[model samples]
Target: MLIYANRDAVEAWSREEAPDNVDVLIRRASAMVGVATRMARYEVTPAGLPADDDQADAMRDAVCAQVTVWDKAGIDPTAVETEGRVSKTSMDGASFEYDRAAELSERTRVASTLCEESYDLLRLAGLIGGRPWQR
Candidate 1:
């Protein structure tokens, strides 16, 4: 398997570590690879682990940044669970509720932007479309 990103890169980017959360980091990194590969229409094989180094770096950075934010928020990005909701009522009786499942956090949005930028870069590089199964 081609690990385009590593613990060192993530640590360097986030400047924090749990020493015990390596598995979680690995899961997030793997997810980044899966999504990036799918977007690039490529298969992640030993021979072609990193179809493009720049794309891989961008994807890894995005995932790592998101993972870091999640860690700071005490949430597991890979966990399949509800983030719950918060409701607030104004003095005038107006009420509002924020839906966690339906909304993205600012940090999360930033991470998504990074990933999108990475995809865009790859697309411009002509590395964005080649389905392995098409062969």
Candidate 2:
């Protein structure tokens, strides 16, 4: 599947390399696109509709937000494991620690959430009707 948001757009929004794992990111973004479109009360075209500028930006930001999620994990989010030590381990008697993923930045969290809300991002970005959202 073709990603609506290009690498440049993702880089501009994220300032990081787009994931080399294109298929995984594309799959995630595709699902979100449906959710976003639905929240906008818009039906997706059977052949796929081109996004307007604001919608494209939102899509770019949203995809980069997901890439950030993987980046924070210090492992390819889409990779499969064959064999490895567990992320958590116990010592001698009872001491143990677990690795924790980094927290997502506020901007990424908000951008992803906005896209998920569909109507919010679409309306706020004026990709939908060029009018303020009804209270």
Candidate 3:
């Protein structure tokens, strides 16, 4: 249910077509989890109860996996600066200065931890459905 727009195509489309594709993409990504849950046999109760643990876990895992893939594909998770002062020519640009490198490393570690946690969470969720959890 993940929709990745071609960056080049999006830019071209923005010029010729409407700019609403951005919003549409956002809406689709946001709704993917709910759609996935329903397809997975989860029914939301009227009491505002959270989704079944297993389903939630699965969703988290899927999200984490998606992030992991993007990370491995060289997308910087800490590139927040908009100023042109910092160079973006290489992967080892100023963005990875000593302090930034350490922070990025720590963040990567944390992301990996979260990925594992999501898997464990999914396992727990499966238990709620009286199904054996598989890793």
Candidate 4:
């Protein structure tokens, strides 16, 4: 699937230099946007972007906003995972501490991830939860 926002747009969105993992971040953000916007209905170009200029811009902005939010949270969606380990274990000594960071990444790991700002932008553009939502 095509990424809704480009590297330059992501930088411009946050007014900061993107991290080295930016390319993967963009792809991940786009996937999430695709799922979120699946319920949206809009005219599309041959490239699969919204036909209207404003709607297209909104899509791009929403993707960029998702990237910005994920970056700020220090969650790298492209990170490789290791074998699953016991999240909670107890013996003579009780250990309640678990991998909280991993939990945060879990939310970002899926294509369903959607930031609040991104949702708002898509909703405002009528690209979500409106009309017939025809792909």
Query: For each candidate, what TM-score against the reference?
Result: 0.50, 0.49, 0.29, 0.73
**By TM-score: ranked, best first:** 4, 1, 2, 3
Which candidate ranks first by TM-score, i.e. highest? 4
User: Model 1 Cα displacement at 65 (Å)?
Assistant: 1.9
| Candidate 4 global TM-score | 0.73
Q: Tell me the tens digit of each residue's lDDT in model 2 across 1-135.
A: 536556666566568766676556556655655455444543344545444555656655655655555444444433423233336566777767553323333334433432333444555654444322241
Output the worst ten-in-a-row residue range by lDDT, candidate 3: 126-135
In order, candidate lDDTs are 0.54, 0.50, 0.38, 0.77
- Each model's number of backbone clashes? 0, 0, 3, 0
Clashing pairs in 3: 53-125, 54-125, 54-126
The candidates, ranked best first by lDDT, are 4, 1, 2, 3
Candidate 1 positional error at 133, Å: 25
lDDT of 3 by residue, 47-133 (tens): 432456545435544444434433443433333222224224446443442335654565554433323433444445652222223
Judged by lDDT, which candidate is best?
4
Give the per-residue Cα lDDT of candidate 4 at 60: 90
Which pairs clash (backbone N, Cα, C closer than 3 Å) in model 2? none
Query: Taking the tens digit of each residue's C-alpha lDDT, what string does model 1 give over 55-126?
Result: 566556655655565556555555434455576666677777666745545434433322444444445555
Tell how far residue 14 is off in model 3, in angstroms. 34
